[model samples]
Target: MSDLEKKVKQFIDRHKLIQKGSSVLVGVSGGPDSLALLYFLNKHKEMYDITLTVAHVDHMLRGKQSFEELLYVKNICKDWDIPFEGVQVNVNEISKESSSSIEVIAREVRYDFFQSVMKKRNISTLALGHHGDDQIETILMRLTRGSELKAAAGIQVKRPFATGTIIRPFLCVTKSEIEDYIKMNNLIPVYDHTNEEDIYTRNRYRNHILPFLKSENKNVHIHFQQFSEQMLEDEFFLMDLAKKTYNKVVSKEKNGDLTLNLIEFRKAPFPLQRRCIQLILNYLYNGELPKDLTSIHIDSIFELIDKTKPSGQIDLPQNLKVYRSYDLCVFTFHVQTKKPYFLNWDKGKTLELPNGRQLFMKEGSVPDDIGQNIFILDENTEFPLYVRTRKNGDRIRIKGVGTKKIKSLFIDLKIPHNERDVWPIVTDQEDNILWVPGLRKSIYEASDFTTGEKVILQYK
Candidate 1:
């Protein structure tokens, strides 16, 4: 067996990247990296005791070239007697809608389509041909773009993906090694013109920094491997620390929201505390940690806790707001811009929430139309509704009960600490909260939609 084949097989055995008799979905772009991956893995399929199929997604941006590439991939799979699946999508429209870069959109589309194939065909692993050199490019780019420790961390050799698992056996190899393997095997790989265009940031690094560094260090490829190894090790340590610290201060509610105990977090080391915060935020916001977040923002947040200015607030980019609440610090991500979690509470009728949800108001009884359920409010109660994040002074009146502090109510209702503030609260003009949207409406403003003429409520 070839050295590349042996190394890949060893990684697979060590990590259990693939299972015997398991269906593997290959994410092939027909590039040198992917081509080499497919060839080597296919050659050793019998030894690995795995069934393999190739999946290709054509963004159709390159027009005929993309189609040809897809066709080439299909033919290659045919030659190997492996199943081939191809999908074509207009990522242009998707990019605009998702507000994602073309590369990001392509990645999502590819994974989504591949996941569909996986479900349809019962495939377990989505294998990609991302080599060690690609990991270096990512690290360099992230470091240049001002990244945090978590952001600068290198890729994992194997990850538990949403569908099943994603493995990159080629990560142990380099781009040059893959190209060499392709040439040795007389492989025909598709060329992505975009990689050379330097239009995107990665191309910029590949063109400018990588070559220059390569000249400076004859064995720059080896240097990339070393860097990835070190970064990978550092990443594991931080993540492990984050995991341990997260368990110390974090708990999840029945509703699936996570609670982070600031009181407990206050005791841990700064790095573990920060890592825990990043982990929670990353899961909530989903995908790549905030790039623009600076040491200044981090310090400012600490100041909120440090200087006893718990009531202070700071707004970071991407509609993320950080506030300190005396006992705890809260970070809220306003997921939607235009909506802004608006709820206009009127005297009589129903007040609709932003999420196509209705908060019905009637004089006496609860409505039968309870998909999301409705809230009752009375005219003698609070007026001119205000919706905002949970504040230190926040309080709520439990139905059939007296009153409770927001923090106590959080413990009572099992509201997660991390989510307590970010949870939208509807308050009257006097700052008296009328309802904790989707949870409860204030007893003071309990309504039956009888007093007001129309259902006057603002929804996002």
Candidate 2:
């Protein structure tokens, strides 16, 4: 009946955030924003027939304070009679394993936990506590990182994330509104000290960039928010156009590489070309694709495509390669051909490559003692593994054939020269060849299947 309730109702209705009797799993951190969210959503339980859950992630970065925060959140959920659950993760280990920052790792681990809970409970909606402040901070951060107009578009009210839909009912609401609600309702939420420190990137935006922008314009947040919404509209149109253009110009080869028609892409406008490149990147490389590969990167790709020789290769950041071969711009995973990235391959484990990447290996059988890495190695296998880029002197033997320089082999194999650098090679401690990971193994090792060798390598 109050104005806040009306506003919440309007937001959910405008976004169609949930259906009547729909269940939402809320990401709560015992912070003011999430606490206020729980209060309002719970208050309207009857009208919407909504089922609510409070899920918290204890990052364990703040020592005892982190545990206390979790307990506080648990108690709050108890007071409201809401279902409460949480998970604790060693974010450092995850960051190291995934080659991601702690911020990214925490998000991944938290979302993984949240989705598992949602799936088990048959929940359809995942509610985040992000407000206008978070939105402005995000935009500023993206901008600082060289995001263009379309990339600077405001975050959506609701978008598909993880297994289900993630809805932000507070996009229209400012941080002050959430705080006022908490203050008026006597809400007690834990304050995270990290938010005050500029150690994290987001904190830098929150602590400095936003305040400076506010000081200069006084209405910078609102202006950017509006700008974002408008940009979103434009982006939506561009993406649709890109999709149409992509369908006309893009095809897939039998080898799973994307083939973009150079003539068609060159014919389209620059924006369309950029969008098409983005689309190709998104579709070909699955799982959390960077929505914003720089214009420079895109333009570089364009230049490569425009002058691309048959089977020509271009390398972009994040290990993305654009192959201009066979009259198609084949977007490929930027795999090092010469030296491969190292995965700690022990006696018993599957080393998962970056998502959706298939490590191409030469046809082979394994001896029983030879490890998965060295499919056909004898007892005299190399150690202290060296995974590096290709050197000039590298050589490999062809089965029943004599040895040949690896360089000549690649050239003969029609491997795009730029792509040759991205293929990973594995070596032993003595710097001897063990495997050309995802490709051919060096001839120093025997390919004849011997005892204790198991050769079952697969990509999923």
Candidate 3:
């Protein structure tokens, strides 16, 4: 076999990225790196029992030139008898709507298109052309941005993606090797103008930082790649330990709140403690760690835990709040809205809450089956049904008990104070609490059983 094929096969075997008879989808952009990847994989498909397909995404920014690139990739796939699929997206429109830069939007749209193709084709593996050079650039970028050790691990060789796995077979190979392979095969590859422009951060790193480092050490890319691999090993160990620590001390509430047992948290090692905090933020943000959660933010959390005061709090990114009240440290997103969410109860349709939650109200007898979020309103209710957060002077008539303030009820339930501000409440026109989801039902004894028409309120 050829040198390029040998190197690629070794990398794939080392990473165990592709199993026998794996159906692979290649993300090709008609560039040198992608074309080189397509060539190598196509030549070795029979040996590996691999089925190959290519996906191309046009950002629609370069107009005719963009279409030309897609056509170029299509022609190449045709010569190899591989399936080729392409899509065009209005990146400018997406950027405006998302309030993000064109570069960020383009990356998101590109990956989205790749995932769609994987799903449509039932491919089990998605291969990309990221090389050692890209890894070095990423590490340098993370270093300058004050990222943590995990961020410094750079691009992974394989990661879960779109019902399968994303493998970077060329991660161990350098850009120089790719160019050499293309030259040896007498093939031409298209160049993207955007790579030459220094406006983007990656381009700046490629054009300036990498060259400077290469001057200091001729094999700087190899050195950086080795360093990143070591970091990845250490990161994996720390992450595993952190996950175990999290399971032990962290308690997750149904209402998107996380509580850390402060007594137990303080006993763990410092590394686990820091990772625990990171995990909490990631959980609150739906597995995406907040970008602004820096070392400073983490240190502040430790400081809050050390404070002598029984109750202390610190604000975090994305409207998140971390506070310690006696034995529990709560991590929650307290959305402080100048205008509270007030909506008239619509029994026919679902009411969309601020944070992707939904409120459903229906007029019927209580359903035999119910979830934690479901509540029942008395059929003889005399007041109008409205949904909003707690307001001062709000009172609820607890079932089998006398009237109590909402504030007192929250305290009695040990609900994190930070979450109480945004905790949704369903109230009647007289401002009487009908139901506090996952907590209690109304005590207003109304004889609704005669008609048996109940207003069922559910938050999901």
For model 2, residues 72-153, the per-residue Cα lDDT tens digits are 8898888889999887777876677786778878888899988998988888889988887788988877777876556567
Identify the runs in model 1 with alpha carbons over 4 angstroms from their true place.
Answer: 216-219, 226-230, 233-237, 240-244, 247-263, 283-292, 308-311, 318-320, 332-460
Looking at candidate 1, the ten consecutive residues that score lowest on lDDT are 451-460
Q: Report the C-alpha lDDT of model 3 over 208-270, residue by residue, as the tens digit.
A: 987888789877767777788788988889989999999999998767778889888888899
C-alpha TM-score for every candidate: 0.67, 0.67, 0.73
Global lDDT of each candidate: 0.72, 0.72, 0.82
Q: What is the C-alpha RMSD of each candidate to the true structure, in Å?
A: 10.0, 12.6, 8.2
lDDT leader:
3
Error of 1 at 198 (Å): 2.3
- The lDDT of model 2 is 0.72
Give the lDDT of residue 441 in candidate 3: 68
Native-to-model Cα distance after best TM-score fit, residue 451 in candidate 3, in Å: 36
lDDT of 1 by residue, 1-460 (tens): 7777777777778777888877788999999998888888788888878889899998989878888989999999899898999989998878777866888888888888988999999888889999877877888887877776755766667777766899988877767778888988999898888789977888898888877876787566556666766777787788898889888887754433455577888898887887887776776567665657677876776676677543556776677776555565556663422324455655555654443344444344344453213444454555555666666667777667877787776666655344554566777777776667666656655445544433333222
The lDDT ranking, best first, is 3, 1, 2
Scored against the true structure, residue 125 in model 3 reaches a CA lDDT of: 94
